[model samples]
Target: MTTKRILLYAALAAGAFISVFPYLLVVLTAFKTKAQLNSTEPWLPGVPPTLDNLGRLLGGDFPQYILNTVIMTVLLTLGQLVFTTFAAYAFARLRFRGRDVLFWLYMATMMVPSAVTMIPLFLIMRELDLVNTWYGLLAPYILGTPYGIFLMRQFFKGLPAGLEEAARIDGAGPLTVLVRILLPLCRPALGTLTIITVISSWNSFLWPLIITSGDATKVVTVAIAALKVGIGVDYNLMMAGGLIALAPMVAVFVFFQKYIVRSVVLTGLK
Candidate 1:
């Protein structure tokens, strides 16, 4: 092979190692005992791999945290998908006064940092007495996101107009066209949205920590944060919890990776 091609391959290999090394450390650390974790060989694999950390985590409130995270992720993803799909379809296909202006104005919100809205959202939740409730944890997110709407809108715009026109000629209304025709055709985009939404909701820490309290409402991310004791961080248990929290997202990405790539490629085409 040419020297230039060899250099390119070496660069790619270095980048891949950099990306995966932390995760490899976490996984290795998860199996190690607390003693091994604290010892000089902390960077190495467990001397004798143990499931004590996993056992302890599952035996405690961690399972409940996992369940809560799953429930919140599923509910929020469904709500966002529904809301974003309708909004995107309207923005892409319908002609209303100031539609372009309104859509652009809404999309501009994405430029604003989420931190800027956190206070106002928290105050709104407090006013509604939803503080520490599941509703509060979900309310700000279920309404759809500017990015999700933008993605769906782009995909919708890329679709052939004639499909909707044909559906309309067949006595289908706008809602019917959306539900029966457009939605089925938008599977790749929907899959991409579902994966993104699920992962975001699952990994959300700050909002959940702020809105939720106690074991009853705490999600996996908050539960994992609670692992930090006053004395010192328990790296083994923390890594175990991290792996547990990461498993679902990994599974999701593995399953829907193709669709995600397809959506990106198609969105670029649009």
Candidate 2:
């Protein structure tokens, strides 16, 4: 048993190093200057590391891209959470006409590839005169997704029915009971959702690419692509931009990752 455990620890340590090596290289490269590149020692950690790459990346239009992405991400995350929670609570507890049918119909849409709907959605946005505006960028995604509704509904179902009954006996309204009682206990699932939402919103490229024009509304992902297009052959600066773009997702995951593990463990969602 001791030998097996020792071997397991050694294997885990090796795997950790292997996974972390690329990120470490990015960090080192982010700090390097154009002069630091060597054909012989490509991965060389430069002595007296310079901040020229980072300075150039941050001291330009890149921050606007980051700011736009951040704004959209926050809006989408909050919008999904609020709307998803309300819809899930209704589906789980409220008895309404065509309830299950409506839910399943909505869920069925999730099976369809988003790409299939993109053109139609863009046409609608353009018809609404939302093109090249924040409204256009946000309109498509502000509503809760089917997957979010399903996850929340399942979690809501797994809770004891008696809890809501007890709240009702205490004269709590449906909204009150959901907000005060259920949401408190849904931290793990919500956290998991938040992490997923933030990452998805942050990395969103395709729809934003279609909706936004020029520098005004370009997101981090678009800006990164622009770096390759505009500033050809500045690898160090590009890596610096990548590091900046990567930081928020890293922070969000570090903060909310426990919820992901806990949600899987408690909710039995794969």
Candidate 3:
């Protein structure tokens, strides 16, 4: 290889290592024993690795935490898909008066950080006595977000109008066109939104932490945070929790990353 190309590859490799090394350290540390983790040795685990940390977790309530996280993520993603798609279809296709103004007004909510709304939401949930229930945990999120609606709406607006027009000519209703014709073609956009929602919902810590009490309703993120308690940290256990919390998102990104690219490409085309 040319010297310039060699330098480029070297720089890229270095940057990759910088980006990945912390996660690599977490993975390595999870497999290490308590004694090994306490030692000065920075990266490598001693002699044999151990499953004791992970085993301890899986042997107990961590699986429940995993389940809670899964339940929330799945429900949240599905709700976002249904609600965002419908709202986007309306904003994109329907010609109701004040549609643009209404959408922009709704979208303005995005400018407000979620932290600002949490107190009011909590108070409302408290007033309704919904706190700590599944409804309480999910009700705030299941309607989806302005960003998702905006993304879906932009994608919907980009499609060739002829397809929907042709479907209309065939006596297809709007819902029929949305479900059978338009949605299928929107696979890339939907997939993009699904993955985004799944990742965000899965990693959500603050809302779940604030809303949930006890082990029952706490998701994996809260569970992981619970590892570092009081004065000291249990590195072995904490690292293991970190690994467990991270795996699903990594798998999700690896699998659905293509859809993100496709959405970008398709949207850019319009």
Clashes found in each candidate (C-alpha, N, C closer than 3 A): 0, 0, 0
Model 3 — which ten-residue stretch has the worst lDDT?
261-270
Q: How close is candidate 3 to the true structure, as a TM-score?
A: 0.94
The regions of model 1 sitting more than 4 angstroms off are: 267-270
Off by over 4 Å in 3: 263-270
Q: Kindly list the per-residue Cα lDDT of model 3 for residues 6-36, writing each as its tens digit.
A: 9999999999999999998888888988788
State the local distance difference test value for candidate 1. Answer: 0.89
- For each of the candidates, the C-alpha root-mean-square deviation to the true structure, in angstroms, is 1.6, 2.4, 1.8
lDDT of 2: 0.85
lDDT, residue 110, candidate 2:
96
C-alpha local distance difference test of each model: 0.89, 0.85, 0.89
Window of ten residues with lowest summed lDDT in model 2:
35-44
* TM, every model: 0.94, 0.89, 0.94
Pairs that collide, model 1: none
- lDDT tens readout by residue for model 2, 127-217: 9998888889987777799888899998899889999999999999999999999999888779767777888899998888888887888
